[model samples]
Structure formats: structure tokens, C-alpha cells
Target: MESYFRYDRMMPREYQRRIAENVIAKGNSLVILPTGLGKTAIALLVADKYLREGKRVLFLAPTKPLCEQHRKSFEELMKLEKGDVVLITGELNAEKRRGMWEAGRVIVATPQCVKNDLKKERMRLNFGLVVLDEVHRAVGNYAYTFVAEECRRSGLHLLGLTASPGSSKEKIEKMSELLGVKNIEIREETDEDVRKYVQPIEIRWETVEFPSEMDEIRKLLEQMIEERMEVLRKFEWIKAKNFRSLSKRVLMQVRERIERSSGGVKWMGLSQHAALMNLLHAHELLETQGASTFAEFFGRMEAKEKKSKAVMRILKDGRVKLALEKASQLKVDHPKLEKLRQIIETGKGKMYIVFVQYRDQVKKVVEELNKIPGVRAERFVGKREGVTQEEQKRTIERFRNGEFNVLVASSIGEEGLDIPAVDCVIFYEPIPSEIRNIQRRGRTARTRPGEVIILITKNTRDEAYYWVARSRERKMKRVVRGMQKMLQDRRKGAQSKLTEFV
Candidate 1:
């Protein structure tokens, strides 16, 4: 750990001091620091202090890549042997996981696998501390709750690390309750104490209008919502008590229609299982949206249901079936795709990273980029068939070395992967989650000036998400600043009281 400080000339001393103070506080704490603000360093400091006290620590992340990133950060900061730290993602064998968990003093793992391991009763029973990274995912049914429960039952210290824990007040309280977090340490990117540690982030917003063809389709689709509602009502797919319950069904239908249309009958027939698997994905998206929302997060859920009902009603009338068919056939570009193309072209000699929300969209980006000459692109997504972790690492290394000028990545690259800094990041569409937004942006501006260009489709769910994220990011920054100020004030008050008593 002392040797690592030789490289610490790059980090701000204030950050180290804050982390030291936090570790000594000796209670559960929620830290709010923006991306690229050294949250991993704080975790490392805490891990070292706790481990020195004969306590093992578990660092939890929402994703495997982030777990790996935290493990690397710990190794770099603590100068520990590889055997001293372990990254437990789903990729590991059960036997290997059991072995690593027992041997490692500092273990980093995805919450899901950790929770499953606990369920399987694989316990060394010596872990005295737990660190929850991206702690915002602590919401309903997420494995974070189970991990927290296990830690509490074990009487270990709890620490939560996140940029935005709660988009709303209820969410914040829920996170607190989940982790037994009694104290919170927040650092603002704009705070005087933290400004020296933050790099400048320039965000450029561009809104693209929907293709003209989709406009009439969108209107006609809206008109048919009543009929769709009636069909669902007839089928009992949704309870009459809540209209929003039917939202999932509508999204599923839309997703199916899109896939079938895109793949055609031949592809769909040959890959029926894959087609149905897409339905599973659509279901997950809807479930995540409906997890805690009584209403739709952005009206996409509600609006889709309403549109489906109206579309069904018109179908019964037989007047708009032909129109609907044409609407479905109308090819609509994401609008920002062209802008992304321009960014890639304009930012010559710089690496461009693009983030899209869907797997299908990721494929579309790769296909589009392939059409361009001398522009090789690769997809960095969750570990799937044909892509091993080692291969993924090699691919990223190649991209960093300029073997590929552009990288088309999914949410996987947004988290803790060791992807090199890019000159420009293009968002295929604005996302609803603030955590994703921050992580996506964090991939850039690590060593030099970087730009983030968000491609938003105007007047659609994309625009709505854009504004929602912006508002939430602003609120989060404010909350972080307030918390930092409170900490400073408390420190000042303590010092003043001590002087007066003396």
C-alpha cells in the first residue's frame, strides 16, 4: 500500500484524507461521488483499515466488470498479491468461487452471485465488512437486500457506495433501510474539497426529430389504444384495478412485432427460441420499470398500453388494418444515428465509444458502422457465447491501441471495465437511469478533453428520459453538495467547541 502511493502523485491528497476520515468513522456510510471521482480509492482505504483490524471485506457491485474494476483498484492501492483479492462474477465455477471466497481477504462480487452463494450456504463466516458498489440497485427484489440481510445477521459493518442512491425521497429511505446505513458521506464533484479531483465534463445535447413516416404511424397507433385495452380486458391479462399492469403486455407485443419484422419469417422460424428469448428481455425491461412505479416511469409503459388498446379497437373496425401494416413497414431511423456518424467522422484520430440501451440497437450500430469503410467496430456486452472474458480484454486492448477506431458498446462498457478513454461518447438514446448516464459518461475525459454527445429523438420517450436524467443529475449534485457542506459544518463546530472548552 505504501509503494502504491508513489503512483499516488496523480491523486489529490484531499481525497485520501477524506477516505481516511470516513474509514475511521466506524459505522455504515453511503458515499455519493460522481463517476471518475475515485470511489474505488475510498473503498480501498476502508478495506485496508478494516483488514488490518483482522476483518475481511466483501465489495459488491451490480455487474461483473465493475467487480473486476474494484478488484484491480484494490490490488493497485494495497499492492496485494492476486491471491489476496478475488472477483466473483457468474463466470466463475461454483467450486472456484468457493475456493476464492475462502482464500481471499478482500472479495469483490456481483450481488446476485454473492446472494446465491449465501443461499447455497457457502460461508467461511469470517467476513467482518461488506461494501456495496452502485448501491442504488438496492431496491426491490435486487440481491443487495439479501446481501445486506446476511451481513446484518453476521454482525458485520456495512458500507454503500453510489453516485445516485435515490431518484426520489422514498428510494433514499429504502436504500438506508436495506443496508442499515446510519451515516452517509457524500462528496460533490463541484465541492471545493473535491474540485481538485474532478475532471471537466462537457456534455452536448442534441435532439433529433422522428422520421416523418413515424409521425402518422404514431398518431394512428395512439387512436387504436381503446381497442387494445378492450382486448386485454377481455383476456384478463391485466387486472381492472390498475391499467398500468397491461403495460408489460403491450411492450411485449411491440417488441415481438419489431423482432419479427426485422428478422422476417425465415429468421424467426429458424430461431424461434431466440425470438421468444427476446420476449423475456422485454418482460425484464417492463418489470424493472414497474418494480416500484405505480405509474409508468416515462409514460412509455402507459402510453404503449393505451396505443395497443386503440390499435386493437381500430383493428375490430377494419378501417386501419392496412394503415397499421404500412405504419409497421415504415422504416424509421433513430434520428441520432446520422449525427453519430458525423461525430465519428469529425472526431478523426480519436476513439469514439457509443452506448445504446438495447442489444438489438447495439447490433444495429455495429452493422451500420460495418457499412462504413475502414471503420471497424466491436460490441462490448455482457459475457455471451463466442465472447470469453479474455477475448473481451484482448478486444478492448486492441481498441485502445487504435486497432478499432470506434467501439460499439452496451451497458457493459459503461460500468467498471478497463476500457480506454475515448475522445467522444455517443449515446444512441438517452436512458432513464441516472447511474447508467453517469457511468456511460465516465468512460471519457480520463486523461484529456473529451465530449459526450447524446442523441435524443424529439417528442418521444427518448426526450422524456433525457429531461428526467438531467433533472435527477442536477438534484443529485445538489444533494451531494449539501451533504458535503453539512460534514464541513459539523467538523468546524466540533473544532470550535473543543477550543472554547480548552
Candidate 2:
């Protein structure tokens, strides 16, 4: 309701105005605001300052769909001519892109396109400000790092934005360094200034217990993994005190070491490790996910030719064979699925987005939800899953226009996509990554109060994943705070040293 700038088009909230003012004044900033906190609005406000200085502004997103979304949002918010605002993509011919590069006052593009153009010398980096959305991806070999380096060389102001950088201090530091971020401005929903604007999100954890039959399958898989680990231990391949206590990280290291070995030993280790991994995956599918998912996975394995002797041995095991048969005979669905249906029924007229980790689960969820009368559901998956970008856009539009009450999606729905705000977000199963967990919860509680429901199977990997995400998120905040303080101390030291010289 309060307007801070001359551009009356966007009624800036108090927190947005403060954050934008700091970012613009600081010049190079990494804005770590939670999702639904109007991080984009802050970017726009800072960009408007650069534009008012008669300089071009370039906004970069990680994906074409996100780039298009930003372009549309800027168009709707800013009073600019069609030619003044351009959305650049690989689809644009070089000549047209060149012309747009010369004439456009504002450009929204994916980092890869900009990186390509820069590499080919097709376009010069002459922007006044470069805004990188989802900037946590700036680490490692991502195009964002290349593009940000170019922006820095061009003497352009850099603005990095993301909900969660990551759980590791090293990765966050790398992201900051790559983006030339001199200041870190982090805001959470619980922050005093942001609390008033944040809509309440009630979180619910729904837990289900695996049946005795599924427990039998889990025990068989555990025994098989232990047998494989013992073989590795006999070879001095794994030094871990107990195989049962070994984490996935240690298992991965063991697998890597086996990959580098030679001869019959290599084959033996590789095949056994592969079988162990597959069995672990099967255990997850059966315990955390449903019997149908496990049955489907087992069927796929059964249909494929035996690639490894260890896998063949696993298939031949009477316990595994019996477990597969029991999975096939599973008549009832996962309790989580039933719980999801009950949640949807409660929110009959409201919109919902159900986030699953697998494409098959997305399809299965859509199918099951559509079976209920008056519940319209559709599957939203990535382009890799055979759903084109255009179809994804259309699906989101249809969802926005109320054509579907529920959208079942894979990890594609977790980050940077322009998903419509829903009344609730249902996690089909708990995930271990803090970044993804935060992103999924962020799909709701934007403009109105919402709910986040996470389904976990008791005493399985679901519970482990749920706890890991929570602990990692807590650690991430501490790391960010420490980074911010370190930056502040460094700046103070430099200023004090300058004063001593004076």
C-alpha cells in the first residue's frame, strides 16, 4: 500500500523498499530472500534505477521458461515499449539478437545464451546491471559463473538472487565469489520486518508404517547389501567399522574406488556394488514409496537382460523372488496416497501442487487423483520427460486459469518455475536435500495462508530424509550468517586501516 519510488506502477512493501535500497546502494549484492518474499520486486526496483540512468539492464535466469516469465513480469510492471524490452533465447536468429542487443533497453535471457553470445563475440557486455536469478547455481561449471565473470569485466553492477544458496559454506562462498557479491542481504519469513508480510504456512507431517510383508523385503535387501559389503571388507576395500553404520557417502566412495580397479577383481566389485545400489533403491521404493512403484521397478529389472552376475544372483534369491511376488499382489495403495486424497478432499475448491521426486510417481498420482469425482489433476514434468517447454507453459497457464485443481509434478516443480500459488503443497515423499525442501515449501504461502504436508513412512529412509533436510537447513542459515559477519568484519578492517593511513 506504500509507494517509495516515482514509478507508481509497483506499490512496494516496506521490506522490499528497504532491501532494494540497500542492494542499489551497495552496487554488488547477493540477496538471499525466501521464496514468496518479493525478491523479484527488489531486482526490478534496482534495475529501474540503472534504467533511469539511461543504461541497459540484463536479467539472467537458469532456464528459458524462467527467462520468459521474468520478461513477462517486467513487461507487466514497467512502462516500456515492445522494442525496449526483449526476451532473448536460442530460438532467436543471430541477426535479430544482434539488433535487439543494440536497441533493447532491457533483456531477459538464460545464462547459456548470454555465455554463448559472449563466447562467439556476437554481443558485447555493456549492461549497467546484471541480475542473476536462482543465483545459487553460480557454483562450479554452471554458465552463471562465466556470465558473471563477463559482467564483472564489463564493470557492470551484479545482483545475485536465490532462496537457498546451499547447505555447505564452501559452495556458498564460491557462489558469492563468482557473482562478485560484496554484500549478502538475507531475509527470512520469520524476520521481524518480513513477518508481517508473510502468510502463515502450517506444516504437517503425515507418517505411515510399512506392512510386515514390505518389512520382509527391506530385511532381505539389507542382508544382501551387508553380504556385498563384507566381500569388499575382505578385500580391504572398505575400512568402515560397520557396514550397517556406513552412510551413502561412504558407499559412493567405495563404488568409485571399485570403478578404478582392474581385471576380475574390478568386475566382481563392480557387479556386487551395482546390485547393492539397486537393492537399496528397491528398498526405498518399497518402504517410502508404494508397492506399485516397487512392482514397476522390479518388472523393469525382470524384463531387462541380466547385466551382472551379482544382479542375476539377486534375482535368483528365493527371498527376493518372494518379495517381488508379494509386491505384485499388493492390493491396497500406499497409506500416503490415501492421506493425500483426504487432504485434497478437504481443500476441494482450492488449488494444490503435489511435488514428487519421480516421473512415474507424477503419472501415478495424476491418475489416482483424476479417479476421484470433481478432482481435476494433471501431470507436470520436465522436458526430459517428453513434456515440451510449450506444453509446460500451457499446463501452468491452465492451472492459473482454474482448469485444474491439482498439479502433480516431479523435481521440475521445485525450483525457478513460474508455478501458480496454491493453497497447499503436498510432498509425495520426503527428500534429503535442504535446497529442494525449501523450494517445495516456497510454492505456497505467498499471497495467502497455506499448508505444507509431508508424507513419511515410519522407520524408513523417508524419516531419515525428513530429519536430514531439517538439520541441513538449520546449518545453512548458520553458515550464511557467519559469511555475512565475516564480510562485515573484513569491510570494517579495511576502513579502519585506511583511517590509520590518514
Candidate 3:
């Protein structure tokens, strides 16, 4: 086993070696190396060299744990006092962050926190170098782009670090342009330099098919579509209202036919309504892109708001109020929870990291797991209404320490968090976004052997998304390896010329 070396403990490994050599050759870089490939080690190695020259450095990770992890690595490498390296997070007070910024040589923080400091004019960026961790997020609305833009505007050099820059060539190039990167350094596990240090990733895909009882429920859903349409109309869905309003006094018969067809289907539980809403949200993502997608989702949310208003409006209408009361009691069965429980009980020995897209779904998983005797489970989420940072840290630490066998988490748990290695990763639902899928699976298959199980509800959007993510992941791996090969080849060509001249 390779020694668990701190930043300054031993000579740099393959990933770090490439980074060190490149930083010495080219002033700024964008390094794309996969997870667990020692990206932080490279950052630390470069920071150590730059700090020795009395240069200040800024390292931006995507989350708090990552910031703390990088800060700890820097402190150990520089052998500095506690005050010399500090982490700036949302949890810290602005005054404390300002003080830390002024005094610290190495400032580690999430991109948003750094952006806020810059926005408030509380922090200065005279640093010689800025390192962007998980640099793939340099896309629209992500704080990484904001921080990188600010660095460029302030005239500071940058080093972008990411496992997969992006799933597509266009996205990868776009991120590169956004970060102002001229040289892209990529490395693959198959490369001579990487092979020595890169652990082999054995990915196994386990597919879950729905039982016949679930299939019957899905068919019944289609049959009752008309009833649901009427329910939505009562809720003042403009789409339903417009269909009713426009067809009135003209083509009344056609409108009636359409309404009769739609109203024929039956709808299920509040839980199912929530599930359907989520499925609709995913469909919106797949069928739309850019600003159009945002507009569509916003439109649906507005419609839902209107529906709720309609419900409140008719509370005084005796007939409508009674109907509304009865509809609210319509319970949709969430059988998946019990299925998940069974999986957990039977797969006890296999370490699992469970992913649910929504926070409420994560809570549901935690609640269900809690009901199972001898099963320990907790949710890992960002600081929100019901969870605290301390709780998140404790949950992570417990899972890492083997005190807990499973971690139920939301999308917040996906990126940049140092979740320990596990044997199995189970997605509560398939995430359509390629970036999210990569980050989720990255928690497992980190080192040693691992498997990913996707629990897809039959006849739902989950089915399509599972394949969509798989295709994207395969494409991304190829792209990462291709970029790495190009860099290595260029390095060899340059070395060959020098040898010939000698």
C-alpha cells in the first residue's frame, strides 16, 4: 500500500508530478484528473512551491468539507501555524473571514463565499495564484465562473482542477473559455504516469425492475388521466382553463371530447403527486435546454401556485370545497420505500451510499431506514431548514468510521464532499444531468471494488434517465482519456526535440 503521505511527507506521486512539472513549465494550467487521482495533492504540491517564493495562493473548492480538507493539507505541507492557513465558509462571520483573508497565506473556501467577500469589497486578491477545485462547474450560474471571472478582472493567474471537465466537447471547451485557460492538462489512469498511482475502477451496473403490482398502478394512472385533468382545472391550471375557456361557444363538442378523454384517468396519492411533479421536472430538463428549460420549469411552478390558490379560492364554495377536501385525501402509494428497506436489510454487508434528488425524499429515506431495526442511516445535506453543519459532519464521520453502514443523501452530498469509500452506491432515482450522475457515482468506486444500483420506477422518467446518464458517463470517460493523451504526447514531443539538439 502507498504510504498515507501528507503534502510534504514524500516525493510527489504521478498526478502531483505532472502538476509540478507543468506549473514549472507553464505559469497557469487546467488539470483534469479523475476523482481519488490525488488532485488535491497536486494543488498542495504547487502551493508549497509557490508559497516558498513568498507568493500568496487562493484555493476554491465547491463545499465546506473540501475547503477544510484542502486547508488541512496546506497547513501540513507548509508546516505553518494555525493562523497561516484558514477556511472561509458561509458559517464564518464576515469580520472573521476578513481577518483570515488579511492574515492567511493560503485561503481555502467555497467559491460562493469568496465571491461574496469580493462583492462586499471585504477581501483583496493580490494572490499570485488561484486554484479552482472541481473546475467543471465553471458553467452558467455556478459560483466557480463568478470567482474565475473576478480573478481574471483582478489580473491574477488561475489553475483549474477537475475530474471530468464536462460530458460533451462543447461544454468542456465552454468551461475552458470561461476560465480563461489557454493550456488544458489532462491525464488518464491508463497513462504511464497515472498507471502507477491510479487505482483501477471496476464499475458494475445493477438494474432494478418493478414488480407486476407497480405496473398495474401505472396503467391505472393512464386510465384516470381525465379525472386528474378535471382536478387540475378545479385547481385553476391555466392550461386546463384555457382549454376549457377557448373552446367555449366554438368547437364545444371537440373541447368536450378532449376533456372527456383527459378526465377519464384516475390519479393516486399525495406522495404520487409529489413523485409525478418530480418526474415532470426531470422531463422538462431532458426536453429543454438553456433559458427555455428554466422558463418551462418556472411556468410549471407558477401553475402549481395558481392551483393552490384555486384550492384556497373554492374553500368557501360548498360543492367545490367538499370535492377539494376529498381529493386531498386521495393517497398515492409509495411502495418504493419498502423496496428500499428490503434492499438495505438484505444487502447489509455491502456498504451503500444512497442518493435522492430532493431534500424531502432524503428525509423519507432517513425516516424509512429509522423504522428498520438494527439499521443506522442519516441524511447528508447542506445547511438547510432542518439540518446543521455539525450534523452533516457527524454523519459523514460516522459513515467513514464504519459506525454507520449507509448514508442517505441529497444532491448536496454529490459534489466535492469527502464522503468515504463504499462498496455500493444506490440512486434513489436516476439523475438526468451528466455532472450530477458522475459526482454521485464518484462517491463509490473511489478505490477498490464498487457497484452502482439505480432504482428506477417502471414506466417513469427514471427509466429513460438511467440510460441517458450511462451514455454520458461513457462519453465523458473517453473524452477525459483523449485529453490526457494529447497532453502526454505534446510533452514527449517537446522532450524529443531537446534530446536531438543535445
Best by TM-score: 2
TM-score of 3: 0.72
For 1-502, candidate 3 gives per-residue lDDT tens digits of 2222353475677567777668656655788776777777777777766677778889998877778878777766556667878788989888888877878888888899888989999988879889998888788898888889889877777889887666787777677667666466767667777776654545543444443433332333333333444554553432443221222223334333345443323222232233334333433232211122323343455466445432333223343333233323434324456667888888776778888776546766787787878788877777675677667878888888988788888777877777888887888777657778767767776667567777666554566777777788778777766665676687789889999999
Tens-place lDDT digits, model 2, residues 50-129: 88888889999998899988988788787777778888988888777776777788999888888888888888888899
lDDT of 3 at 481: 60
| Span of 10 residues, lowest total lDDT, candidate 3 | 286-295
Which stretches of model 3 miss by more than 4 angstroms? 1-11, 92-96, 189-192, 196-202, 205-339, 371-373, 477-502
Please provide, for model 1 over 159-229, each residue's C-alpha lDDT reduced to its tens digit, 9 standing for 90 to 100. 88876674565677677767766567776667788776566778987766656654554344344443444
Order of candidates by TM-score, top first? Answer: 2, 1, 3
Estimate the TM-score for candidate 2: 0.92
Q: After superposition, how far is residue 475 of candidate 2 from its true place, in Å?
A: 0.6
Measure candidate 3: CA RMSD.
Answer: 10.0
Task: Count clashing pairs, candidate 2.
Answer: 0
Residue 370 shift from truth in candidate 1, angstroms: 3.3
